[model samples]
Target: MGVFYRAPEPGAKPFVAEGDLITRGQQVAIIEAMKLMIPVEADASGRVLEILVADGTPVEHGQPLLTVATGDADRAGPGR
Candidate 1:
């Protein structure tokens, strides 16, 4: 949420794309609010499933930016 931006700037390549492997804390997108750019990072390491918003698109608070398919280790209990 908060005005999603897939790319750093106009005509620039996106930080990530569908099927791209992402790690936690890795910047996936940017959210601009009040002229400040806020990095949107991955909560968990995973493969990107989809990008829910376009570059420079305004987004709402709590709106999903993208879907990620985290590895089983993230979902399963330890010692399994």
Candidate 2:
């Protein structure tokens, strides 16, 4: 429902880059609309395979921000 931003602000480092390992609920990007910064987080723990959105780009609701390669532990379920 807002614009997707890979970085917190222009010229700043992105929250996550390709090949980076991320855990569930980890902030990967932000969505800004009406001056509100909404954090976009990972749904599962995994290695980042790709970033589907560019920094400061506009995005729609349900749009993918990136692709992640889920780890075995993630696929096997929690507490593995």
Candidate 3:
């Protein structure tokens, strides 16, 4: 229900990247819909393995934006 909007500028560093370790509740990216910006956060702590979605792409609810190598499978949460 939203479009994935990453990085504030064309060459700005992304909030997170592959091989980057992130903790629970860390800001990952932003979703823009109706001109409002929504922040995406991590649900678990782990190393980011990959980014599943590209910037400026539309994403659905519960869509995974990235993958994390967490200790617990049930806790793996890179995005909603």
Candidate 4:
């Protein structure tokens, strides 16, 4: 499973599971900074399996925000 990066504040918009399929730098969610939209992106390619944070929920830096299964079981690495 992949780890989700959390926003650094409370009452922020967390990543969206149904959002666009993103790559390493694609926007996943938005955080309001000075009334500006900050885009969040995926660090790796995978299907989002679950959301750890709720909508409009408070979050902190370095917190887990979601769970993603890479979807490629073949790539699980060295332990097959």
Per-residue alpha-carbon lDDT of candidate 1 for residues 1-80, written as tens digits (9 for 90 to 100)? 35788889888989899999887778898889988998888877888888877777788877878888888756421110
- Whichever of 2 and 4 has more lDDT, that candidate is 2
Give the TM-score (vs. native) of candidate 1. 0.86
- Give me candidate 2's TM-score against the actual structure: 0.86
Candidate 3 local lDDT, residue 76 = 57
lDDT of 2 by residue, 1-80 (tens): 67888888888999899999889888998899888998888888888888987777788888878888887778622210
Q: What tens digits encode model 4's per-residue C-alpha lDDT throughout 7-79? A: 4455565444543343554566554544555556656666566666655555555555555555463343111
3 versus 4: better lDDT goes to: 3
Off by over 4 Å in 3: 72-79
Ranking by lDDT: 3, 2, 1, 4
Please identify model 2 stretches exceeding 4 Å from their true place: 76-80
Error of 3 at 79 (Å): 4.1
Residue 45 lDDT in model 2? 88
TM-score of each: 0.86, 0.86, 0.85, 0.55
**TM-score order of candidates, best first?**
2, 1, 3, 4
The C-alpha RMSD of each candidate to the native structure, in angstroms, is: 5.1, 4.2, 2.2, 8.0
